[model samples]
Target: MPATGFDNTIEVVAVVVVVVVVVVVVVVVVVVVAVGVDVHVVVALVVVIVAAVVVVIVVVVVVVVVVVVVPLVVVVEALVVSNGLWYYPHL
Candidate 1:
């Protein structure tokens, strides 16, 4: 016996439907994993932790500039120059 044209078309359609379903499942799984936590959580824990780290670094830099570096610079400038003129007569 030989296959007819209609049978060939039905087989192609079935294959296409299966491929589409598989692709959809894969996409959904990838999205879920990328989120790193459940969808119900309003804020992802991973994102919150990263933001916290950034805030800590910014605070440390601000504290260092105010407490240690700014005073050092002011003292050095006062000792080295006065009235916008170099204190030493010769370079």
Candidate 2:
């Protein structure tokens, strides 16, 4: 079926709005994760985990000390410590 000009415009606008909303959501999530944990450690694991390490790697964030002790290695280098935080170990 042939679409009208008004329909096309609405479709384009809808696409644009969806794209913008997705971008904003991604940025907000990233910012929140970054601020909550250490960016460096998160980069290693590719996710935020309150910046903790295995065998008692405690990192102070804000006014709290987040301790990490990875018990299981789900992925190749991903470590899941306490407090539901996961991170990667240093080489």
> How well is each residue in 1-91 modelled by candidate 2, as lDDT tens digits?
5442233544554565566556555755767677675665346444323222221121123112111222123232343344346553642
Model 1 stretches astray by more than 4 angstroms: 1-43, 82-91
* lDDT of candidate 1 over 1-91, digit per residue (tens): 5543333444554565566556555655665577655663324444544555565566556556665687698778777786655665563
lDDT of 2 at 55: 10
Q: Report how far off residue 58 is in candidate 1 (Å).
A: 0.4
- Supply every candidate's count of residue pairs whose N, Cα or C atoms clash at under 3 angstroms: 0, 0
Error of 2 at 45 (Å): 24
Clashes by residue pair, model 2: none
Question: Candidate 2's C-alpha lDDT?
Answer: 0.41
TM-score of each: 0.45, 0.33
Each model's lDDT comes to 0.57, 0.41
Give the C-alpha lDDT of model 1: 0.57
Cα displacement (Å) at residue 23, model 2: 0.4
